[model samples]
Target chain A: MKINPEFVTSVITKFIREELNKFGFNRAVLGLSGGLDSTVCAFLAVRALGQDNVLTLIMPYGQTFPQDVEDAKAVVSLLQCRAMIIDIQPMVDAYFHRYPTDNPVLKGNKMARERMAILYDFSAREKALILGTSNKTELLIGYGTIHGDMACGLNPIGDLYKTQIRQLAIWLGVPEKIRNKVPTAGLWPGQTDEGEIGLTYEEIDKILFELVDLRRSRQEVIASGFDPKKVNLVWEMIKRSEFKRRMPPIIKLSSRTVGHDFLYPYDWDK
Target chain B: MKVVLVQFSPHLGLLDKNLDLHYQFIDRALEEKADLIIFPELSLTGYTLKDLISEVALNPRKNNQLNRLKSYSHKIDIVVGIVEEGNPGLFYNSAVYYSKGEILAIHRKVFLPTFGLFEEGKFFATGRNFKTFPTPFGQVGLLICRDFLHYGASYCLLAGKADLIIILSAAPGRGMSENSGFTSSEMWELMGAAISRFSTAFVLYCNRVGFEDGVVFAGGSFIYDPWGKCLLRGPDIEPAFLSLELELEDLRRARKTWSFLRDDKPEIILNSLQNLLAKNED
Candidate 1:
């Protein structure tokens, strides 16, 4: 779906400012992976809070691409915000050395969680909120690791689809090299998001825009010319990932449960 | 008559803080010498309050915060939104009209939207009536957010001979448009224009701005003349104070040129509704 980048930019910047200000935080920390999503978040965070207030952490594993690292550094220099490069290999390897495994998924998840741990650690170290970078497509398809890449104090781009984030990137004057680069999680060498997910963001976002946003049924989506297999796949992914989107369900023994009935706005009395 | 629209964000569940904000804006409006000032829906209690609704609900007849707001009306009229604690347990999303240091009228929101990002129906008691009250400016009719979407609600006000229809909303921004502004806001503007044109009443819409739990309120408030022409439009997604002097003559001229109100057939509609309801009961 098409979006007016200028309007999106204005609203998102305001959202960043207000969401942070309400929590008595003027600074933010985010894991900048040199990908389109994190880079866009970094730009918006800088625009909302000044460059001096945003801290970007580049956490790369041993197999992380060198170009991605360079791109992350380039973005930091371009935005002139604070940046720190912490090689996550030592921490990750230390954990895996005791319990070795070659499963890429498990190793990738460890890396993701490792980066998140550092982001939160610095979140307290700098007294800054953790800004999230997960896009709607990834979130909908269960592509992110829960409590890892999925965790954040506030998400500015969670509502935007991956395709829309690209559109926004162009409008925000993101570096052409990063914008045109093939999307990747940089979890391992030769890994691409589309290859791992088995669907391009363009295809996934279109399917999701119909299935989730427009609330189209599976048959209806298929009738609209999407492959039934892909539609079902996307549908299954959404249903499976529903748990990641919500807090852990609490068994209700009290009159009012925390998430079930004891509802209170997050910014209550702030 | 000069009217001021205060497009602001209210802190969630904080009555004293939001009341102080109202005083600041009222003071500013007084400095501008405006005849009336309006705030958005739940201006004193932020939207998206679930259990906090009861915690923030005010007893309009006895609350010190509301009385303080009423005191400001002695200098200039005030229209603000509040969670009115009705009977013992019934709480309504209500709008208060204060004039001459008294509570002139209260319009509890008739429509409580319950679907999709809104749980108002679960927390608020449904309002049962729509009535227009007299003010120094004109016969002013008040409606909350979802009430404005229901054309029949405005029709009731039109039937009551409302000269000015004021809508206070904390509508969240939804759906992106091709050019500018949210698509949901376009719907509000469309309704405002159609209502003003058909009823020949000055439509003044005041909407809030700011994010509450990630849902941003669209703040493109506006004023429309009786001819359905926009008099003033507020900024998008930002809090702003908008003021305009109403040309009361425009209302007279519009009503004269358009016979929509004069040739109205409320009796026929009422009789048909009576028959329909009778048949439904059968």
Candidate 2:
């Protein structure tokens, strides 16, 4: 499932440019988490709409990794795009202080949504479209907050798996530090994506490439030399996370409903 | 004969805007003095039109826009894809071959791909016939994207003595290859080559480029000669209006050399199919 990174890069940059142009926007805003996915998107966005047109928002919570923040800053400096450090700690903590949630997942989800809110705010202020950074792996497993990191005006890397994103990141000449780092959501201290997902992206991507892209059955994927439990887990995750990949289904009462018979393309008439 | 392939991205559900875009390209083709101009499937109404298909469906018999497009055929033979409203509620994904201010032929797409990312079967009525019409270049056959994938469709055209097969597609770009191009695009090229070589017909594929709800159409429109040699290829994921001078003499030479058409036994195959169908029914 390896991709021609150069071919993919050209397609994505053109996609970003044309999609944004269709919406009459020359500028784009994306949250930079110092992760490979976001970093690659930043590079592509800068390539499509000049460095001056792309804005990077580095929003870190109180427990966010310092190295990640540094890496994010490094990328912003490297790309020479507009960068803003908006600490989401106060807003997330303020909400938690009022709501009183001790659960890490709840806190993490709050942090993600807070960052999304700030990104949109900046998007409105800058009149730039918010570019999504969630890769296919995260999207398939529903590892992202529904309306948080998942919310964006356009996504250039949603079809690419985590492994493919790493491949693309390497081709894009992303920093070795950023490329080699363990993938994480940076929601809490000492948290890694593989740890939470119960499998490495390498393993997850293989199973997903079969189960999703190739449309292989769980048994067929296991037969292809994957661990049965992991294959089953990946299949289950894909099935369970279907909601995260789509709009909320509207109950159709009228002849033409928004998400039903009244379907139109997102770029319709624009 | 010179052929111009207008590889363009149509604004989804915007008929008038896409018409304007078509006119722009048509004018360009005319300026180049091309004999034929081909556009990708649903050139007037962008692909991925789910419910919007009905909104954009054109009755070619009476539509003013279609009439205007047909008017250009007086100057150059134009082949364009459109949402053809055959009857009141029945629509077909169709390719119209316009020549001399009249539609010479309308090939409704036989294979309406409904599975995977496509929902054409849901919106369009499946076409029944595979017919070829005479063109100034040669006898030509038209097939939409999915129709071209079914070898039987090409075979039917070959049987109809088609010397040129034009495929109009809004094929979504998918499957990355380790090498230079998309896996989906490679499949098209492979099929185009095989069909061209076997049928001894020039295969022209015109595919659109642009994102429709995140599914981007691969715009690697290409032309294959009668000998299955690629003459021209448009850029992937980008809009291009490419013109190619096709040596019509190549068709005569390839046909004489291979003689696949001359050595064909359609009668035996037809009899075999009829017997098989009769037996199956029994």
Candidate 3:
């Protein structure tokens, strides 16, 4: 379906409002990454829960680039949502110092989880639901940390793509600075999205829409005139991370299991 | 502060008998004056409800047993499974967060497992969104079995920012593992370990024990602190309760000591995760 952004926002806001009431909650919380997804979610949340009930946290590890911080502040200011910046460098440094791991990936992951911990702490105190900024692409690929950035009570953009977020960003009138900022995980200096992924989001999105939405097979995909390697690569990720999408395998000891047997989440009937 | 987890071997296709067992277990916890008491998933009704969930679902406004449990809420908070009427749906495996006096929260099972011998998808609909509820004693999160397995559950609780995650489970099998009779207990252990490590949230898992429909539950109720260290254990095949005291001071210290959620690199992971998402097809 070609969803109009306004229609989506209305449905999402309605979802948020009804969900909060249904679950006996009113407030919401989210980390403002100043990126397209979070920026878009911030605007959506402001519309959904009102700016006053929405608290945006900017968790910057000491090494965060100045622009990223500025952009985060810009989004919060433009959207008029409650925002705060919490420096996480000291906290992250302590873990590596104690364990002494040189693995940058592990350290980077540690940093991400720490940011979430702080967000949770704030949420704990604030009594708010964590609003997620993850879009469909990241969730499907298991791109976010398990409990870090991947953590949220509900994700608004988890079903959208990087390019889709960009579309929503422009539609929502996100500041040009944030909308145009080089997408980075902000792990270290001079790192960008293309550097790590080896393909631009534009190129990836077209492949994904066809594969995911159109349900095209590899031969069909290449037959349609795309690089075979890209098709193979994307398929491999889906095959590998398939576990991330479903419940972990549970050995059936009971007739019903939460994993393999009896499965359910809380408050589903509504 | 000590909590008792009763990993009971519930009778199959039995709700009234199982609830009677719940009363017995609660009485035992009260005998010990345990601060919190927990049970496995769907203990009130058998796990694999088929269609009986709708028939047996408790009407909170009318059900005497549920009301009795609500009255019991004043003594200790109970996290047990029950079927409740939900909007647009027939039944839910709900964790009625009740203390001795009143019901604190009602968490409908959201992640319906639909694979293998289990088929929750046939009955229960997944829950919407929820937050961690604050009790007088602590900030708590209630996630039914598979909910604990998903990143979504921890994310939701972590997003609500819960300090302690109580996973009321009916997880079966303790000795069987994947790939040619591997040990399933190890999987549960590793899962419990990873969940605690990742979220920095104290963890509690109460699994059922019994033999029904050829399914054997090895009741292994385990609790881990924020650092992924085991705090207590219960028998693998008994309708018994295990209790332990947790210091809020210790939790605060663990949060200070383990800063996993605070130091993250979101921008990079997001790119790597979604790189293919925006890709074009041939």
TM-score for each of the candidates: 0.98, 0.96, 0.51
Tens-place lDDT digits, model 2, residues A1-270: 888999999889988988888888999999999989999999999989999999999888754488889999999999999998988888877887889977888888888899999999998999999999999889999989999899999889999999999899889999999999998887678888899889999999988888888888888888879999898888888889899999898888997788887767677775
lDDT of each: 0.92, 0.90, 0.74
Query: What interface root-mean-square deviation (Å) does model 2 yield?
Result: 1.4
Indicate which candidate wins on DockQ.
Answer: 1
> What shift in Å separates residue A135 of candidate 2 from its native position after superposition?
0.8
Candidate 3 local lDDT, B1-282, one digit each (tens)? 778888876654566777788888888888888878888887787675565567567755456877666777688778787777766355777887787576778888888889876778877776776569897667788988888778756766765667778888877652321122215556677878888877787898888765444344656689988888888777644456678887767677777887765654455556765786668463
DockQ of 3: 0.01
lDDT, candidate 2, B1-282, per-residue tens: 999999988888889998898899999999999999999999999888887788999888777778888999999999998999998889899999999999999999999988877788878898999989898889999999988899989999999989999999999888888877577898899999999999999999999988888888889999999889999999888889999999999989998899999988889878998999989955
| Chain B vs. true chain B: TM-score per candidate | 0.98, 0.97, 0.87
**Whole-model lDDT, candidate 3?**
0.74
Candidate 3 error regions (>4 Å): A268-270, B1-53, B56-282
| Per-residue C-alpha lDDT of model 1 across residues B1-282, encoded as one tens digit per residue | 899999999988898999999999999999999999999999999898888988899889887867778888999999999999989789999999999999989999989999988899999999999999888888989999999999999999898888999999999999985577788889989999999999999999999999898898999999999989888899988899999999888878999999888888899989999999989955
Error of 3 at A211 (Å): 1.9
Docking class of 2: medium
User: What residue runs in model 2 are displaced by over 4 Å at the alpha carbon?
Assistant: none
Candidate that beats the other on TM-score, 1 or 2, i.e. the better one: 1
